[model samples]
Target: MGAAWLGRRLDRTIHAISYDSPEDPLGRRVVVRAIERITGQPRLQRIYEAYLAARRDGDNLWQMAAEYLNLTVRYDPAALAAIPRTGPLIVVANHPYGAPDGIALGYITSQVRSDFKVMAHAVLERAEALRPYLIPINFDPTAEALRANIEAKRAALAHLAEGGAIIIYPGGGVSTAPHVFGRATDLPWKRFVGRLITTTHATVVPIFFEGQASWVFHLVSRFSETLRQAMLMREVAARIGAEITAHIGAPIPFSDLTSWTDRQALLDYLRSTVYGLDPAPQRRAA
Candidate 1:
């Protein structure tokens, strides 16, 4: 009965992620289903009751996120200490696991500094759990969406100006299945990170978090991009107890970025820097 109720909303969810993952409670259905697949319906219900009780008792969304992560994620922190607790900063990373990675970033950043935000795809802005940490960018290309994006940019700049830190995924979309000649990879990053560096002169950090969704998640993309994202929604929760490796690179100053005249070269440099933390995810056969 729960699956039946969630089925249509999940279906609608797929269509939405071809563009960006929607911030919908419907998305919660996918994660809940994943948890139920392992813990059974009764236990899942108990977990929800606990969460609702927490809400009633005045627990914040971030605390709820930590509770969820305690059950599912295990990541090592390496060199994360190199990041300064107080400063204007920009951390750029590859969007390998989409939503979960954002949560990981938020959790890690909050550990270092309370005054920080992530520049995220606008759809993620809808998640009440992530609201305090997100500066959402809508990629719809429609005028309204573009306007929303502009506002997001303004906010990001203001945060940077205030000496707060921010995180950004250069790849606008989640990493797609590897191209014919490449391993699973993100689309090219926008020049926005470079622009941000130039504009704010914020310290930039490149982070590489190891791991990806299962092959099952990648296979779902063969049918539709949205479905792939939806499947990832489920897969992410099922990753409980999984080990995640996080490699943090030394920070780079804005003056260093200013010398690079070639946009492609700059992106390649950033991409290679991230891949440097570990071997790049193996590319598919050409």
Candidate 2:
């Protein structure tokens, strides 16, 4: 049920992120056809319906995501406990695993901090179960999308200013080019984190959990991005006892980044800090 719903929403919002305009009906249909061909609408519907039923019966989305993906989530309680429980907190993480990553991240954080909300794309933001925990963001660059962005910014800033904890996937979209950084890495970290910190003076906590998408997901990216995303369930279903790990680092106060002159530099610094926790070459390969 949930899958069917989010799938439809993704079809509609494709233009919101892509070059096409939301008002163009023709563009919408094209996007749907392209994606459906890749994901197979019939299979997508069956998977979503079953997932939705399970989701409705439980308050734990993390477990649902893990079970659906066939993954075993593992995190260090001591590492999570090491985070300072003071001031407004902002978690900056790599957007590798896309949807499942958010669920696991939210689940881990909620265990330590209850006042948690994620800055998510408009699609995930629409999930009724996740509505309470999401601050919706439109990826379009239109005047309307710009207005929507401003509102999202306002809401996120307000939430932080109020000492609430929020999680942000700075990469915005999931990682596409695997060879860009010698491994799968996000496109580019958005400057929103810098802006958020400057305004709210929130403590930025960086964590790294490599994306677990299958090679097929990455290989197919060479063709169509829309179809690649539409077929994420194939990646999800590949995880059987696969371990998802997160390494949390100490907080970096907003003031600490004041000396970083360039905006992109700051974003890079944050991305590297998170990537710093990535498993060393041998371990990752082994």
Candidate 3:
């Protein structure tokens, strides 16, 4: 990958390393390399290598990601069975552990419906293996990101119109600690998800991933969004061999969603409904 690509994807200043320059003044290369090492980028790179290796061995990205972490997922059987076998379906979930939750939902839903796509961060599209399954949305603030997002929305709408399923985490970003010592909760969700539901008349199924990333992640997130993004892969690596519990809620038909005139209000209700499935006692208060 090019230096610009690395800088964008990894959220580190990789461009500081002047590969073509014979005399590197300002020691910027040293500072950037130190930042990468401190953020565990080398270890994350190794993990990405294993992920690509899995693809070479004929595994899909979701399956490979789950296997790399040895992640075991348990879903509510009754709720899972409630999903309509054929129709436009939207699987909404709380954003807890970033890749783990997305990969888990993708792996589980794929078993039920082969024609499904996930609305995911554009950075994941770099995997190449995941492009078929991902409808990428660039979260970065580049001039091109808005255009890409609009195209992604059009693609998602078309996919649903064709009676395909979609998986989305309404919270545009990961859950974070409300305060220094508070429980983690999702950032305010966007209204576009509700609009999508209304437009497609898709059946809404909620999934609650039962845990958050390491406390250190939440703490780091309180400081810088860029640093938080850089830390995500390392957090995933920390959960190697972890058993992840995901709770599926009863499917809310489009009929039930019609009462709310305001899409943002509807989105809020859906957010609360998903969080309601969290087993943690004080989650509602958060």
- Point to the candidate with the largest lDDT: 3
User: For residues 1-286, could you state the per-residue lDDT of candidate 2 as single tens digits?
Assistant: 8656755665565521122223334444466446554444444345556777766553566666566656666777788887656569999888666766776788778777777788887755434566888888887557987898889889999988888998999888766655423357777778877888777878888988865566666777767665565555445444445777787877888779888877778888888888887767542321
TM-score ranking of the models: 3, 2, 1
Residue 162, model 3, lDDT: 95
| Per-model TM-score on C-alpha atoms | 0.75, 0.78, 0.84
Cα deviation of 201, candidate 2, in Å: 1.1
lDDT of 1 by residue, 180-201 (tens): 2235566788877777777787
Per-model C-alpha RMSD: 6.1, 5.9, 5.4
Cα misplacement distance, residue 40 of candidate 2 (Å): 8.2
Clash list (residue pairs), candidate 1: 72-240, 182-284, 183-283, 183-284
Model 1 stretches with alpha carbons more than 4 Å out: 1-52, 55-64, 71-78, 179-182, 279-286
Q: lDDT by residue for model 3 over 163-194, one digit each (tens)? A: 99999888877888866566778888878898
Worst 10 residues of 1 by lDDT: 15-24
> Can you give the lDDT of residue 212 in candidate 1?
68
Off by over 4 Å in 2: 1-58, 67-70, 178-182, 281-286
- The lowest-lDDT stretch of 10 consecutive residues in candidate 2 is 15-24
What TM value does model 2 have?
Answer: 0.78
lDDT score of residue 179 within candidate 3: 66
